[model samples]
Target: MKRLVITLMLIFSSIIFSQSNYEILPIKQHLNDIYIIRMLEGENIGLYSIIDSKGNLLTQTDNILISVQKNHIYLVTKDYKEGLMTTDGKWIAKIGEYNFKEKYSNMYKEAENNSEKEFFIVYINEMPRHKYGYINYKGELQIPIIYDEAENFSEGLAAVKLNNKWGYIDTEGNVKIGFNFDEAYDFKNDLALVRIDDTSFYIDKNGQKKLMKSLFREGKEKIENLGYHIGSAFEGKLKIKEKTN
Candidate 1:
């Protein structure tokens, strides 16, 4: 009986040792059967590979892997060009001009769930002068690189800067809100906060004032919770006696 127990313990140890050899990465970045795996033991530890459901090697490439979307694989070539590939290792399309954001990291893992816009933001030229624009999933430029500053789309609108003024634009690049504000922010709950000259207030989708007594009271309560009065919270941008109709 003692011998049998010792033998069973040895077998269990062996099973654990073998199972610890590899690590299955995040599933959101992979298809149903395809997965990104990394070696956790032996000399090849830390090495990554693309494998099938049955652990069969699919294909190997030195290009930096970005993310998988639908049937296409996004990758960055050795020469810094961004492109796509098939699951069976065939080239789809390569674009050289725009450098994709997070080229070396895992990007777009949950992009499908977090965004409604099909376009992603990209920048051109160097810092302090990098013009911003949007691109489709197929590496096609949708919006021209013209904005001095840009933010991601929220509720079908993105806040962008032009001629040193901020405004909102739709996914089609049409100015939804006129460029007249000194600062702007993304929309949330059908309202966006904007500032003109020294006054800060909230606006609706049509660029109309949306500050009601309820919103003002809510802001005051939140500011007080943070140990700040509403007058100081807006830094003189909000008037103390501003009537809310």
Candidate 2:
């Protein structure tokens, strides 16, 4: 009886031990190779320099925090916000915070023809009405922030909401695409996925809807969440999952 109890306890302990899980993803800077890192335990996660494919933690655990693009986990942020930070720890932008929505919709103006326009979030001191505009990446309010909301730039265009309508605008702040569309998404690759009424369609870089789904750029591939989503197209492969007996 004593032997049976001890055996069961040992088996349970072994099962728990084997279930302990962690993930390591590869990192890179442009064509330069960085280190692989992962977020573990709590809010604090740093990119460790251990190069073993098995994710060994080495001496330089102070490098990068990762975001998986494909199988390669690119360094996107190191801050607790886990927002984007340069190697020198500068705030470039926060991922997933670029979208602008209201009680109505997520819309914007089109990019101006043959012009350079940028996306911006207009900060207002009071409620509603035209106010100061701020640009993303490029820090110049070329266009006044007269609109209620605005979003980031993709494929040289952004979506802005004004007078309770949506329109597309070039980075130059010109109304290349008028205030239209009930809702829209930032461009990925070369197409922006948009939803108007009850229909969803893919728009080209020029903001023209592509009726043929095949002609449309394939949907942006989601990196494996098990390991991490690396930046850029996946070069390395990682299978992040639990081992089943």
Candidate 3:
């Protein structure tokens, strides 16, 4: 019985050893030139390293590495900010420039595969004011950071806020729709919702008002039926004059 137990122990140790050492993982779908090697036993345990097709180490190490098709490598920095790195170990977009923590993946998901005009939304959260713009996969700033607020591209257009008013701009940074609404939303089914003077309605791609799906239908009905309260902090700041006999 003692001999059998010793043999079993030896087999278990060997199995663990085999599973922990430098193991080459499966090649990524589009990134056929690089392979991911995982080190499960040494000091770099739980980390991944990028290697060329010929087994040459490209990146020193990565906490997490994701292949965003078309040879773009996504990596998270030591400080938790995300950036794009080349397979040969070069930074496409410097770390900490944009806080793309959870937004990096979503950007590529919406991108058109291999489209040269593709742009991803980028923003800075530092002092002064937070501004938004667009950037290509190569980290080139296609649009200047001038907008107060911006949304992702939809139907080749994006809703942006300038001077406290919302409008739509094409991928080329040209104003496709004039800035006139107080609030604007993304386009879906060739229509978008916009609000002005506390009234909300849907508009088409041409900025023409469409008579469907009023945003404040319920609120308007209530106001028309029972009237509205004013002056009270919970109600609003507007004051109403009381009738005197």
For lDDT, the strongest prediction is 1
Where does the lowest 10-residue lDDT sum fall in candidate 1? 108-117
Tens digits of per-residue lDDT, candidate 2, 68-125, equal: 2211222322332222223323334444322222111111222123232233354544
Give the RMSD in angstroms, all C-alphas superposed, for model 3.
10.9
**lDDT for each residue of candidate 3 in 33-118, tens digit (9 for 90 to 100):** 66667766766676766667666666655545554545466666444666666555555676566654224442225323543335
Q: How big is the positional error of residue 187 in model 2, measured in Å on the Cα after superposition? A: 0.8
TM-score of each: 0.58, 0.38, 0.61
TM-score of 3: 0.61
Worst lDDT 10-window in candidate 3? 236-245
Model 1, span 112-165: residue lDDT tens = 543223566777776678788887655577788899888888998999999899
Candidate 2 structure lDDT: 0.48
TM-score: which candidate is best? 3
What are the RMSD figures for all models against the true structure? 12.1, 20.9, 10.9
- lDDT for 176 in candidate 1 is 97
Which regions of candidate 2 deviate over 4 angstroms? 1-120, 128-132, 136-139, 214-245
Error of 3 at 28 (Å): 7.2
